[model samples]
Target: MLEVNHLRFSYGKNPVLRDIHFRAVSGEMVCILGPNGTGKSTLFKCMLGLLRGWDGKIALNGEDIRQMKPGERAKKMAYIPQAANPAFAYSVLDMVTMGTTAGLHGLRVPGKKERTIAEAALEKLGIGHLLERDYTSLSGGEQQLVLIARALAQGSNTLIMDEPTSSLDYGNQVRVELQLRKLTEEGYSIIQSMHNPEQAYLFADRVVGLRDGYVIADGSPKDILNEELIEKLYRISVRKVDAEDGKGRFFEVIY
Candidate 1:
């Protein structure tokens, strides 16, 4: 459902992404794993058309993303950043309902339908109680769920998130991962940049390893993750163990 080819981007004289080529199929969960300053975030920005001045092609559903209009892109792609610091003190419901702005432009504001979608998204994320509370006053994990609800309310086919579980505790992280798996099962394409390799191994159907702005490995988590590759990419040795799921593919990072 999403294809990126020979993608290259830079800031001033320093290059960030170099000749990156990958694809994500419908109902697939792809995890982008990379170290700090490895251009994972930059690639996401380019995919969302948030950054320009790059060389190469990014296509969404067979159309060049650069040529698509913003609103049109919004309808196809939903983005949830690693961190969001909204300036205003909007309620959780208000923040999530903003996702419909691109599709609900004719009206002065979001209508009942839009509100329903936003509220449903929040409820699905298990943050419905926070709907009436101030978004800024919530904890980090709560804010993250609210942002994800906002993205879901956008009603897009592809969901792209950067470090969606960066600040959450173990319980919350598991909740988010299960929800992500559920989203994929329901036929949504997901592309996420993640720092945790264990989470990637458990949740992602495919893993793309990036290092120094280059594509290092692209394959199934079992095919791409190993002692050597883990050491090379993350400078750590991870031990894989038998999982309770009996899938013959479950692993854990034994630091």
Candidate 2:
């Protein structure tokens, strides 16, 4: 459903993404795996149209993303940042309602119909009970789920997440992971950048390994990701204990 072709970008004289190429299809979860400075976020910014200049092409469902209007882009892709900082104490429903207003006009407030959309989005994520609660008062996991619901309310089935679980604890991280997997099962194309190789191996249907601004490998995790690549990516020695349901993949510091 999404494709990046020969994408290249830079910050002044320093190039961050070089000749990056990949594609993500419907009902699939693609993880861009790399450590710091590997151009994962840079590539995301480029795809999201936040960064431009000297790039080949990025298309969403056959339409060039660079040529898409802001409203059009909002309808095609939803970005979930690593963390959310809400300045106002908006209710959970209120926060999600904002997403439903992407195509709304000026001086317009969300009415009952919009509220219904927002509520259904939350319900899809199984958090409808928190509708009236304050957004900032929820736990990190709940807050993240709310963010995902907000993205859903925007009417986009494709999600681009920048380290979606980066700020949450282990339990919440697992919770979000399960939700992500579920979303993909429900036919949402999810492209996420993550530092945790284990998460990629366990959760992602396909892995795009980025290192030094280049795509070193791209394929199924079990095929492209192994002990050697794990060490190469993070410069650390951990184990990739193959087991069922991705439950046995774990990492520990070597003495």
Candidate 3:
């Protein structure tokens, strides 16, 4: 449901992204993989219209995003950052309900329907029990899930997440990955920038590898991810092992 073509961006005279092109459709999970300073986050901002004066075309559901107004874009795309730190002590439900504001206009407050939507979103992520808890009191993984719920409650078809599993422990990382798989099954298009290539191999329908702000590899994990590509992208040696269950593959850094 998303298409980016010839996306080129720069700050002053220095270019960040060059000739970037990719596509994601409904029910697909696409992972953008790269190391630091590869312009992954900058590319996301360009897609979200948070940055302008960039060259290229970004279309959502067949319409150019540049032509869409802020609210209009909000209705079609939702973003989930790493983890949110709330200024005040707000309940999980309160934070989630805020997503509904994208659908409402003027001074109208969230009512039963909005609350119901938020609650449903939390339940879908299997975190309904934390609904009444203080958002800041939860663990990093819980906080990330709540943010995903908030994005879902916004009623967007596409979700863009920046390092969704960045700081979580192993168990929490698995939890988030499972939820992401569930979202894809339920028809939410997902694009996430990830540091972990193993996570992409395990969950992503497609992986786009970037180096020096250019797409170096793009395809299904089994097709594009290998020892050579990994070394080229990260400047490190690694080994890939097939899963015993035959689901997919995983990688390990050779020391």
- How many clashes in each candidate? 0, 0, 1
Ranking by lDDT: 3, 2, 1
Error of 1 at 137 (Å): 3.3
All candidates in order of TM-score, best leading: 3, 2, 1
Identify the runs in model 1 with alpha carbons over 4 angstroms from their true place: 237-255
Task: Tell me model 2's lDDT, rounded to 2 decimals.
Answer: 0.89
Q: Encode model 2's per-residue lDDT on 200-255: one tens digit a residue.
A: 87899999988888888899987888877777788888765556665646666565
lDDT of 2 at 115: 97
Compared with the true structure, all predictions reach lDDT values of 0.88, 0.89, 0.94
TM-score per candidate: 0.90, 0.95, 0.97
* Best of the candidates, TM-score: 3
The Cα RMSD in angstroms, rounded to one decimal, for candidate 3 relative to the true structure is 1.1
For model 1, how does the per-residue alpha-carbon lDDT over 151-217 read when each residue is reduced to its tens digit? 8899997999989898888887888788889889989999999887778887899999998888889
What pairs collide in candidate 3?
A: 1-25
lDDT for 97 in candidate 3 is 99
The regions of model 2 sitting more than 4 angstroms off are 244-247, 251-255
